[model samples]
Target: MTIESSRAEISRFRSAAVAGTLTFDPDAARRCADLYEEQAEHLAQLRQALENASETEGFGGFVSAQQLQAGFAHKARDAAELLDRYIEAAYRMKEAFLLSAGLYDEADAAAAAALRAVDTRVRG
Candidate 1:
């Protein structure tokens, strides 16, 4: 995706968050975190599998095949790097979800406490 597109999506998400149009559900956030963790693990496994399958041992007799395999290996390494970045992003997303859940829950508790204090003063 383009940088502009990513910025736009981030802006939209921020706007929604600021407007409270998106409700924060701790349970949902936790579920999203779990999903992200799973995705990261899957990507890691996929990257390892790709590396294993890209080995040049089977094509030793053919110089052309070895060259092709070398090219494939290079591309595979690039792909593995990209996958590693994606896995890192997934973990970051998971952390963000968990942190937001904790922050929002704390805010809610604080608000409830303030309201209860107001209630007691009003009764007095």
Candidate 2:
């Protein structure tokens, strides 16, 4: 595929990643994960295709098969890096949700302590 097509695919994957994280619904989150997985696979395929093309036609001035393979390897590495960032973002969002829920626990603890303090004051 052309560079334009590759960029478009990357954009689509990035959008899906963002959408999945922004959504609060469990179903949507699952969809997002699925999309991310699909995107990663596509990226891998694209990288291989580019490597093959470069080998056959001396891709953009690549002098040898080794150079073509290296280019694809770099592309694959970039895709993996992007995937890691997306996963990390998802994890952080989940952590934030848990922390929000924990606030109620903190509130209950504080209330219980206040009650104990009042009881001791009255008894003393």
Candidate 3:
């Protein structure tokens, strides 16, 4: 991936993320799964971007101080990986939310199940 391609992928990912919305009991599984898969792909793209960044070291060496600062591939890669981990956790939260909905037949029971799912997911 070149710098141009990385920018394109990042733009596409941002568009997709912005277009997504969370629904409580409606199409939760499919919606969450779709987003999870997209985020996973985004992670792969980010990795490729980092690889491209590393290969662009020669270009960075001839650039100005500001460009050198901006060319810090390792930092960008670390931050992106960390963000992906958080995104992965959010997908799990969505899954837990759906599980809560499915585990109970009554509204009150669903509330209890939801609480348990959220607590367990958040704490552990």
Give the top-scoring candidate (TM-score).
Answer: 1
Q: Which ten residues in a row have the lowest lDDT in candidate 3?
A: 102-111
Each candidate's root-mean-square deviation in Å?
Answer: 15.6, 19.4, 12.3
Put down candidate 3 lDDT per residue, 1-124, tens digits, no spaces: 5434644654454344334532245465446545654664565477557656644445445558547656576576565555444444434433443443342233233235334434533553
Give the number of the best model, judged by lDDT: 1
| lDDT of candidate 2 over 6-91, digit per residue (tens) | 44654554444344542334445445444544554454455456444544443565467668767776765555444333333333
- Candidate 1 has an lDDT of 0.61
Pairs that collide in candidate 3 are none
Q: Give the range of the ten consecutive residues with the poorest summed lDDT in model 2.
A: 91-100
Q: What would the per-residue lDDT of candidate 1 be over residues 1-124, giving only the tens digit for each residue?
A: 9434643654564355546565457888778767877887798798788778666477676889889889998888777766665665555555555545564553344334334433433542
- Per-candidate local distance difference test: 0.61, 0.44, 0.47
Report the candidate with higher lDDT, 2 versus 3. 3
Model 1 residue 35 CA deviation in Å = 1.0
Give the better candidate number (1 or 3) by TM-score.
1
The predicted structure with the larger lDDT, 1 or 2, is 1
TM-score for candidate 2, please give it. 0.35
